[model samples]
Target: MGTAERINSSQRTLPYVEIMDSTLRDGEQTNGVSFLPHEKLMVARMLLHDVNVDRIEVASARVSEGEKEAVRMICRYADQIGKLDRVEVLGFVDGHLSVDWITDCGGKVINLLAKGSLKHCTHQLQKTPENHIADIKETVEYATSKGLSVNLYLEDWSNGMKDSPEYVYQLMDELSSVSTIKRFMLPDTLGVMNPLQVIEYFRKMIKRYPDIHFDFHAHNDYDLAVSNSLAAVLSGAKGLHVTVNGLGERCGNAPMASVQAILKDQFHAKTGIVEDQLNGISRLVEGYSGIAVAPNQPIVGENVFTQVAGVHADGDTKDKLYYNELIPERFGRKREYALGKNSGKANIAKNLEELGLELTPEQTKRVTQRITELGDKKEIVTQEDLPYIVSDVLKHDAPEDKVKLISYVVSTAYGLKPGANIKVEINGQQYDGSAVGDGQYDAFVKALRYIYKKYLNRTFPILANYQVSIPPGGRTDALVQTVITWHYNDGLLRTRGLDADQTEAAIKATFKMLNIVESNL
Candidate 1:
């Protein structure tokens, strides 16, 4: 067939693209990432119900008993909701084993994996093209007989298109007769293709068989998956394969978030994805996979929506000059201005605006300077830490700590719970308290609580979280930075301290919190 003959005569200006999220199967190929059966089911539900992805490949055929159970669980739920056709399983070109495995697990679709590259077909399977075609024919026949719909995966299709176009065309020519095949999936198995190659090759395939539904699966070996996917779409490809957090083997597949964003913004193609649920699903996958995404990963990363430069925040205030189409609100996230040495007055003002606090111009300048100084010490200033810093910098005569820790002795022995004895002063009144706890810091907090409740008649703030970190290449005498978050008055407060001992560092942070609470009171 020639290019002119293969072009779709009724093609529209912009194609309606389908999104197939393989977060469960290909995403599980990510190193050190595995979801439990229930976790897989939960992810499947969210991807289908919340994210509204058109289809989900749940698992590979006959991997393990655990994988089977996970697949079966997801299939059961998908079946109950009348969406069993939306769930698919990856299968080999084995005659009936893959088909039977999928059928037994309640899966209705089998994405049969076949070699697209002549090298993979010849070396990986050590079979000639003729024999490989025979195997795939038998597999398709068996799958169809078992009442399963089928999609064909041309694994390593990019290399195939480059090095063995004849072999690729030959395989497609043979499989074109398989009328039950729903779609043909082409994978850049080695992550080697660039956008130009994708466009060139995809156009060739589309021109050859414009009638066949084609899906492009990209890998991020060169950080080009998103670009390549867009190129494929521009070349008239019909579908995309993606994973949440870009989880897959090696460099992973194209990230669902990035692909969706580009398809809508650049290509003007439409997908069924609900943009608001993208971040929620990304976080869920990250937690289950135990893989922390880079802070700068597009769309769903932690700092992608953060304005770290003062100029950027300043532009944002003046009619969103620094903003783009990828607004944080579109993904159910709020923009943040980082507080650090790089932060400018505009950045501080932005944070203050979020906190609903008004400060004089001088006060804002002093606070910004103090934040920069703290940042110079490599300290992280969270929004929760701003009020305390402001009070400390503004008050010339530091407010007397109404509740003061006069003395404390904490000890941890080999077989006993840690114990603390503490003396505190409140309004010139003295109180001594002792307590035992799971740790020395816990005991100290308990003793302090005793004084607050019994002697001072006040409510102590609840410790919500505590984190301790030593600098890189930690040494025995290295300073430990302890940041403690406290809950008070329906809000959160954070304070930090540095010392050689972790417990002492926490205590110093607690002392800072004490003064903060006192100043506020």
Candidate 2:
């Protein structure tokens, strides 16, 4: 088929496309990312059971004992859940070596790798297309004989179609008759193809091999993986290969969350992905990979659902004018209105509603002004900080805090456990406590816990998370901001504090948390 003819042809709609996650295999190719065996098992279980992707490629055959162990563990878990066939491993066409390695690890499926382009066949593998085909057939035969289903990867398939269409055809023609080969995975190995090229090339492949199940694997070198993936689907590809948080070699692969979102929201296509679990899995992968997800990244980013402008917040109240099909609730997240220089009264009102606080028009104006001033100075104000901002703005109207910090002294010496002495007032009753701990912050928390438990006969909230940050530019004298998350009454509460010292900032945040708890009581 010619390019124009293929491009102009009627587009086909797929009711559903299979999702094959390669976070453990191809995603591990990302530099400085190596999941421990247990971590690999956790990710696999989550992908297969919780997120419920159609398939998972767990590891490459024979990489290391560690890789082998990870694959084995994943396979065992999958088998226990009756999902053994959904777990696949990448293997080479080296006769029976790759196949044997996979079968030894209890893998039920092998995705066989083969050279797709004439350049790769002749230069990289130093073999003609005929030689490469023979190796692949041998491996497929062996893998089938061992009772394992097989899929074939056309490595560098994008360049193969562009530079050597004849070679690609010859290989496909030879392998199309292999009943044992379940799927043909076409990869843009160098991340070179644009969406237009993808549509053109994919149409040709689908037209020539109508009976074949083709899975498109994309890379993000040009930041076009998601677009190319959509194009491939629109052009009739039956499956897609993706990684969590786009973790792969070089730039990365198409991220699972993004691909799923676009498929559902843009194309109106269906998949097995559990949309609500996308954010949780993304965070899990981010923690394991030590690669941070950008705050502005779509769907799973920290700020994607936050409205930063006053007009946007106003529009939201007027009928959700700024909302789209990608609602945060679909992915287990909530929309937030940011309080900053650009945030007008609408944003403040929205935040106040979330906190269950109602204020007079004039009181809200004062609070908005204070927030804007803080924002102009580049200070971050979260929804958790709104109550404090309101209390400060309308001091006479605000009630006295039920809890307050009187004093605290934390000390650390080279060879001794850190010690803390603390005095606090709760409902006007003063209490003193002292304790030793592994660190200064730990000591301080221990002292507070001692006071709460011994004097007040109360259970302290569990410290769920703590984060500290300073202004950019590596300024040593910059003020520190501490944010702490606490688990109280079967829910989570967050508080923020700012100070010149890190410990002091954390202590301030702790006091805020205590007051919040006391107020509820």
Candidate 3:
């Protein structure tokens, strides 16, 4: 089907999505990484303002002096801006320590963690249900007196509700009637339940406490976090908890991107999710946290919406038969076609559409076979390198190889600046350039840009992105591949180059960029 005829069948009127960003709180708990005081404040502001997450859990109160200082700065900013209600902190059940810390930090809301499972209550706390109930009551009462809103977390409510229903019901009964309790946040602490269990447990709670607001939090131990979250919502959950890119402890929390998409598409649920900002926000979190987002991650992963099989690409051409509700555009991405062992003429055609080129059926078949052979050798073939593959397959010089790099010399030493001298021919015209820069690659690009702007009188494309990759195996002389993306007035242009040396790989790709620009001109 034509792009003009595409329909957004995923969206219908649904309950508003309540986004709770945990990037500062649970996200910081990621091993070996901690955002400094100002970093937490910066992320908090961005989460609330740019991404428009409804709520943010800034930090845990009383964790450490650094944590306290971080929350203090965040709350100071949040309070002056009247976002006190939206900024929350996780606090323990310790009597005055948590409450005092939160108040001092200018935090208004506290998610008080309490034991729900029988094992934790009996083993960890070594207290009976009645005694624990009294402790919670005192803590809630104290927090209320301090003008802090209280939310109780039945730490492992699912397990408690299943194994010790009597104790769980009695505690909920008392807390539901408490004058200071604003909400009851239920957590499947160990992530033991399925969707059916979530439905059963949530129904019981809603029936028992008809007036209380309940927020359901999920974990992905069973990989059913998304399904169970939906089940909770269907059974009358007032709100749900989500972390951007699923940044949490073991197995990660439910990914906000997937939860938001599934809810809006299948369940017809509405959320305040800025559908377009999902990728950028995920990238920012990945960069700040130093965690590599897996390529197969549900919503924001690189390959989630890509079609790798040739049959799928062919089916996509015929009214988009291969598509489901998760269209890439919905989450600020585009569908991509992969060309490798599984590719056919259809996949090649789809990629050709993007590069503004077409080929005869015979030529496309030949190119597909060549890609498959390369894939069999474990070589990744990207669309940026498709022209070179086609040139090898059809012997046509790729239509954009008018510029070629003749040779280059670059040197880097321990205590000295990096420098480079490069020679290239553009449109059969030779240009020699040299420069010293932050690094050899930087020097090379600067010299090339000088030649383009000063002598050729042309506007150089900005390097939007540059990435280098080598195969997983350890080989000192392994081939390095460099991909460069150039941004100009019309749009972006990408090119790839491969060589045994890293610097040569980058230089080869730069030469391809020059040729692409010349061809366009």
Candidate 4:
């Protein structure tokens, strides 16, 4: 179990590593986070069916009645899908209590938690290692008698290896003989192991119990969960415990997406995960967990696939010189070229291609200059904003807007509905319309719709989606950017506007949408 042996072990073709996602159990432990029964059910379904993770630890037994109900719901769905065996619950070494709770909720697997470190066993539980082992054995025996398969979690196993190797060895030695324990999950419970230490310790465990399945559970106190996970696999660990979005108590656990990617790409290890579903499930968990995934998080992050440097975009255009094995498409995302001060012609061209627009070299230079100006002012620009940028920069050659908002006034009072009065000129004909609505924007849109429907007898486009974004720093004067999507004819159209007022930005975007629709007509 030395470095040379670890290196040699890694050189050999690695075995398929089973992935056990503990998002429901470990991830739910995040501060200020709680998942209701339905939320838990949805996340569990996505992990098992869509993401295709090998197993899911849904809950810790006896936590609460609500948790028990969530487990029941997940178990029912999993059973219907023939995935009941893949759902597991964390059970304590409390004999029949944890086991009966799980069986009553229809769970088939119990991940039995046992003390691994001498300090935890000696201080926390106030029991000798022998007493703790007996308790675990009793629990495992009871769980087996109840027809539930068992896995053992050597809690704080990393510290046990570092501080008391004999204690960990003795526990493993005693438990390895139990034919019913399907796996031994070793946790870096405090997020304290470096990669080299992980390799050293995991190799020792693998060397001692070569036949037993060892799953590495990593915490990210040192931001080394992914690295330590790789090291564990290199040291011949057979499985890994991860959580969606890396959610867990304190820092977090090894993220499912990152661990899976590294295991497959770096180690050439096989897993059952559906890579394309990784991003989707990350987003799903983010919504339900209310823990935002960092935009720069690997594989499933928002900005990981974005080409921010113009040189990278230039390289990408020429035979994909900047491409790597971590292609965005592998995770159901497409590469995006960001428009900013750093954007070069290549970046502009890449975004243009996606928008199905072609620009002359001179036009591209002007648009690039305009985007750079916006970037310098700390404004955000999206691909959907490109058309408007192009029109503004080349206004001399651009045709006049077919639909124009001459004037608008919106008012709201505490005792009454908001109202809007608008004057619009379409095709050289001016019209005035007024309407009251639930909000100022709604009233404005209704007024505009009244002009199109009553005065012109024309079908107004349906507003489909509206999103507003403000740059960071939270300054009151910070510019707001609004992007609106409209359903017009057989296709969808997007328009963007930027202004100091959010309502004004939305109105500008609405005007842009009207002009685009009118031009098409």
Point to the candidate with the largest lDDT.
2
Q: For candidate 2, lDDT tens digit of each residue in 54-173? A: 999999998999999999999999999999999999999888898999999999999999998999999999998998999889889999999999999999999999999999999999
Write the residue-wise lDDT of candidate 4 on 256-365 in tens digits. Answer: 99998888876678899999999989988888887888889999887899999899999998999999999988998778899999998899999888767899999999
Candidate 2 stretches greater than 4 Å from native: 1-12, 395-400, 404-465, 472-474, 486-492, 500-504
- lDDT of candidate 1 at residue 197, scale 0 to 100: 94
TM-score against truth, every candidate: 0.80, 0.89, 0.86, 0.84
Lowest-sum lDDT 10-residue window in model 2:
4-13
The worst-scoring run of ten residues by lDDT in candidate 4 lies at: 467-476
Ranking by lDDT: 2, 4, 1, 3
* Candidate 4 Cα deviation (angstroms), residue 136: 0.9
> Ranking under TM-score, best-scoring first?
2, 3, 4, 1
What's model 3's TM-score? Answer: 0.86
What lDDT would each prediction earn against the true structure? 0.89, 0.91, 0.81, 0.90
The local distance difference test score of model 2 is 0.91
- The collision pairs in model 1 are none
lDDT of 3 by residue, 224-288 (tens): 88888888877778778888778777876778888888877777777777878888788777777
Q: What C-alpha lDDT, on a 0 to 100 scale, does residue 79 get in candidate 2?
A: 98
